[model samples]
Target: MDSSGWFMWALLSAVFAAMTAIFAKLGLEGVDSDFATLVRTAVILIMLAAIVLVLGKWRNPLQLGGRTWFFLVLSALATGASWLCYFRALQLGEASKVAPVDKLSLLLVAVFAFVFLGERPGAWSWFGIALVGAGVFILGLKR
Candidate 1:
């Protein structure tokens, strides 16, 4: 894919993430957050499985490299934890507030990439990350 294609995909991801927050907030009514998370995970698993099968993209998991498997497992664990916390937050807080706080991960990702991935974001990129941090901070202030 073209290097520029990432922007479009990232934009779509943001759109879907916004939808997820709204939908999850509504779905949490009269439901346990953890259970709701499980249901959502199951749905995602089924949907992705179908997509993979339809696209003939299924590969033997056992054939993957140990490092790949390890990191994928770690990533999956982190995602699961994030979903659990997000669902609970949605259960107890306003979606508008919770979503922005959740997006604090964007700033965290930049910092982590710089430290662990040896990714030196340019000055403009750092400026953008700072803006995101400030936005999240401003949104977090109590009325």
Candidate 2:
């Protein structure tokens, strides 16, 4: 729960996300997108349940209130939708291309945070966003 722990979690998440793209591309070689998504979701759910049980956090969900539950459900649905689209894209396009396009969501998130969360990123952050945009544009032009 400390800063280093959070950083490690973020790093691990990124690694796993990259691996997900590779594995998904392989898995979708001859599979329909929808069926691939279902299989992926089922496997992730089972893995998550095992982790929660092993960590003794199975009851953690019982601590959520109505608003938390609503948001959690909404987030899960959004995640599922993202996975569906990501897999579909992977099935139909190059992983390098699809991954960069998917990462554009970070720009969208930054804009949303600025508008809704009143977050004002400093000059460096804005520069980083500009660079990401440029990179995405260049990636798109590659094909």
Candidate 3:
């Protein structure tokens, strides 16, 4: 099986995301969710900065155009909001159920890509999204 590098990276990301929810849930015990998110964000920022430095990928910040800055800033703001809400949800809910609900973003992203980016996914992709939706609904039930 020849797996693309992008697929491998995405797989790793999913694994890390799963671990993140469990670890965060445990760590958030008796802690403020907002404070936990701040600490997590700070660690991520420092780690990413270290990677940029180590890889010598630094470039002139001024080189980025306004359009780039606009989208990147918006993405950053969205990410921060999502994290805040997610952490708060995790603080109040069970990780097992919360994580599946959070993963509903995958289906939402697919639909958003089709609508906003003009990237169309075919039948199988739609089936996958439906399956994801069903899975989320199943996990959400208090059985």
Candidate 4:
């Protein structure tokens, strides 16, 4: 994908993420966190299956070796855990509060990317990270 395409995807992802927080908060009003997570995962699995079928990528999984399969399964498990924690947080706190705390992952990702991926952030990106950290602190102070 081109840089602009990647940028658009990131922007769209942020929008959807904000909407997800809102929806999760609303959905968890009377539901238990575990049940909500299971329902959400089921829906996501169905959607992902549809996308895989549409892109003819279902067969691509068959070509994976043992190590790749292990990592993929590990990643999926990690994602499920993160989703469950996120929904539980939403159920326990205000969306405005929980969402920003969840977004602290961006700072973690930046640090990990620099250390592992050898990807460096620009000065502006560093400034943005600082701002995000400050915002998270401010949000925490309200609790």
Highest TM-score model number: 1
Name model 2 segments beyond 4 Å from true. 60-63
At residue 92, give the lDDT of candidate 3: 96
lDDT of 1 at 73: 98
TM-score versus the correct structure, for each prediction? 0.96, 0.90, 0.95, 0.90
Clash statistics: count for each candidate? 0, 0, 0, 0
Q: In order, what is each prediction's RMSD in angstroms? A: 1.4, 2.2, 1.3, 1.9
Off by over 4 Å in 3: 1-4
Give the least accurate 10-residue stretch of model 2, judged by summed lDDT: 1-10
Residue-wise lDDT of candidate 2 within 1-143, one digit each (tens)? 67568878888988988888888898898899989999988998999999999998777667889999998899899999998899999999989789888888888888989998999999999899988888888888945
Candidate 2 displacement at residue 106 in angstroms: 1.2
lDDT of 3 by residue, 44-127 (tens): 999999999999998998999999999999999999999999999999999988999999999999989999999999999899
lDDT of 1 by residue, 19-79 (tens): 9999999999999999999999999999999999999999999899999999999999999
Candidate 4 — worst ten consecutive residues by lDDT sum? 134-143
Candidate 1 vs candidate 3: the lDDT winner is 1
Error (Å) of candidate 1 at residue 134 is 1.0
Give me the overall lDDT of model 4.
0.90
Best model per lDDT: 1
User: Lowest lDDT 10-mer window, candidate 3?
Assistant: 1-10
